[model samples]
Target: MSPDIRDEAVEMWFGPQHVSAHGWAAKLTVVGDFIVECDPHAGYFHRSAEKVLEFRTFKQGPLVLERMCMLEAFLAEYPYISAVEQIAGVEVPERAKVLRTIMMEASRIHSLQFWWGQFSAELGLFAMTLWPWVDREFFLDTFEELTGSRHAVSFSTPGGVRYDFNEKVLKKLDRALQRLEQHLPKFKDMLLRSPTFRMRTKGIALFSYEDALRWGLSGPNIKACGVPMDLRKDWPDLNLAYDLVDWEVPVVDNPDHPGQSDAYDRMVQRFLEVETSINIIRQLLPQIPEGPIVDPKARAKTNRLPAGEAYGRVEGTRGVTTVWLKTTEKAQTPYRAKIRGPCFASYYSLKHLVPGSTFADFIVVFGSLDPYPGWWDR
Candidate 1:
């Protein structure tokens, strides 16, 4: 409590060891455990992914870039593939369109499952992490069986999904969804009754509706703040006309608890979204039409996009991720390409959240926000 000690600079090695440190070592500057500053010493697992993409063929980059974030493979690839397809002027098949919608929802569920689990872990609740991961694994297995890879399927291509499905695959997806429906209520009860979890997060790390809007927060962050701007329902053009599918955007009324966009509300909103994603998958599966996976037999093993500039974006696992491609008129390689990740906005908000809070609260707030650094560092 002495003023001299308080004013003295102190540095600490906070974590390269924590489970939620996002696979990097962080050297945090602490004014006695309050984390006045943080320097993220990134690249503990860096593979020079962005640079490597240039060496790979256009078709090959999809697989390589998908690995940029293990939890967000779909969102990462969707934009890339969409951009390539746009430059090539290829029309995606209707069956492929429906499949992309279903796959995207499944991927969204996978990432949110991880986020929900981590949110509970941050609150010191272990069961919440366990149950949802176990349930989500079923979908992972389904993706693996369908696409030949679980985490980074590389299933999507410029024009359509790389593969098609059969009746049996649909049946399997239906069964897994049925299990999710059955167990979700139990998961809800566990979170609802956990007094400590509720107390720790209920009103902490609050963000107002204005704060969310000002910061350009989307997905569950917006939903948690009592806004109903779901990309699937509200902005269908983003997904190449995914509106034909029937689904509801879940919304909440928290005017009494106005500006109640705290860690608790964020977690609760994700839980609700997990349910909505499951419903979307269930509804989309049976209605999926029978058709060829890809038609016209793509021009070459590797696609050469036309020389021009195009930016494609998709509502990803975290929020909105965009890809900008500029091609030289004749060259097979891209002249320039850019990836815009969603986590940057969420991470930037830490400046606003951390100053007045204690260190443990910092971890709780960061984990609840679920800013995946692998995507950001890329």
Candidate 2:
């Protein structure tokens, strides 16, 4: 608050150039090693995806959505598809429901693996970084087998899915899961139990459950604060098959923090998220009935949707992702499409969470929130 302290504070930008920043940047005011202020920035990666969605046909909108967050392509694309399905009144078949759930859970696992590797690398644990990424390739391989593309596989479409689970696809998916299950224990022990990792992450970027909710945090970030606020259970989609499986929303109750979460708790929470997703996939895989993977009249139905408005929400890998859609009568494309990405709030919360922490730990706090620039920039 004093003039002398202000004189000593040095202001600097943390990226559009920083290796860790990717398509985002932040302005930080530092006094020696401690950050006196943080101004989190967005818009660097803006691609007008929401506007682009309005131009795409009802059935073609998922392709644009998937590109926003390719790591969870299946999850990323579903919200748009969900909206289109609602407006068109297209019924998703039982077989399609089961398949969509299975692949969505698989996409969740793939995304978590990518996050684990990236977060570890940001913490300067390079070895831990490559370990999970190597395992992640198996998931990519499975995705390739299923949709003939890895990252931007437009797997989920309005009224159903684009691809059916062939025996080859099932075999590849099982092998990927097996590899992840086998290596996850060892990876967790190596990273979570390490003294170095604890020294960097434990008790860092701490936020109470109430504060997190106030900041609009969700997914593992909220789950780590001892709240099981998962949309999969709380707001289940009738078209999806989550209700068929018996599963509980994973939550982390850290005794030391008591209704709060630190970086360590969030890291643990993501591990539990991956496990829960794997369990869901395992249960749903067997129940995938032999029938149509898409609605018989889906193409005809989605050709011209009646005038309506719909909200599509999904419990994504990062958090609660949603799409709000509006259409005119006999419209070939959406009249309006708006996306509410989970990362936008998480990135904004950095202004509150980063100040008073050391400059070196800024990335740790940012990465702990698991923000993807596309989520916010769009």
Query: Which one wins on lDDT?
Result: 2
* Poorly placed runs, candidate 2 (over 4 Å): none
**Ten residues in a row with the worst lDDT in model 2?**
291-300
Q: What is the lDDT of every predicted structure here? A: 0.73, 0.92
Instruction: List TM-scores for all candidates, in order.
Output: 0.90, 0.99
Give the Å shift of residue 99 in candidate 2: 0.8
Give the RMSD in angstroms, all C-alphas superposed, for model 1.
2.8
Compose the digit string of candidate 1's lDDT tens values, residues 21-112.
74755565567657666555656666776666666666776886688777868667888777777777677677888888887787888888
Give per-residue CA lDDT, model 2, range 223-335, as digits (tens): 99999999999998988999999999999999897999999999999999999998999888888888888876885788899999999999999999999999998899999
